[model samples]
Target: MKVRITIMPQAAVLDPAGVATAHALEHLGLHGVSSLRIGKLIELDIEGATEEELHQACRDLLSNPVMEDYCLEVIS
Candidate 1:
């Protein structure tokens, strides 16, 4: 099976990557860009687990619950 996962920093955390990207955009005359956040998109293939089980896997190992949040999707 194929799975897609998205991981992002939590709202309360400061994102240095996002800050730098927004600064660069401003310097490049990209107005109205507002802001941005950097996140990770992970695709993986696994065997011997159900959809719900995969979610648990994400909770247990794929993400840091305190500093980040994650979303899991089954692609195949």
Candidate 2:
């Protein structure tokens, strides 16, 4: 099975990298780009793991509880 994990910054946290990108875009003359947020997308292939197991894996390893969040989707 194929699994996709998306790790994103939590709502209450500050994303400095995203802010920097937005500033850079503005400097480059990209108009009307109000906001930018950066995140990670991880894809993995696993055998003998169910959806629930994958979710646990994300909770344990793919995300930080204090400042990050994650969601996982399974694809055949």
After superposing candidate 2, which stretches have Cα over 4 Å from the reference?
A: none
- Candidate 2: the clashing residue pairs are none
Candidate 1 residue-wise lDDT, 20-73, digit = tens: 999999999997877699988889999888888978877888888888899988
In order, what lDDT does every prediction score? Answer: 0.89, 0.87
Displacement of residue 17 (Cα, Å) in model 1 is 1.1
Which candidate leads the pack in lDDT? 1
Q: List, residue by residue over 1-76, the lDDT tens digit for candidate 2.
A: 8888999998789999999999999999997887788989999999998788888878888887788899788766
Mark the regions of model 1 whose C-alpha exceeds 4 Å error after superposition.
none
In model 1, state the lDDT of residue 27. Answer: 94
RMSD in order of candidates? 1.3, 1.0
Model 1 per-residue lDDT at 50: 89
- TM-score of candidate 2 relative to the true fold: 0.91
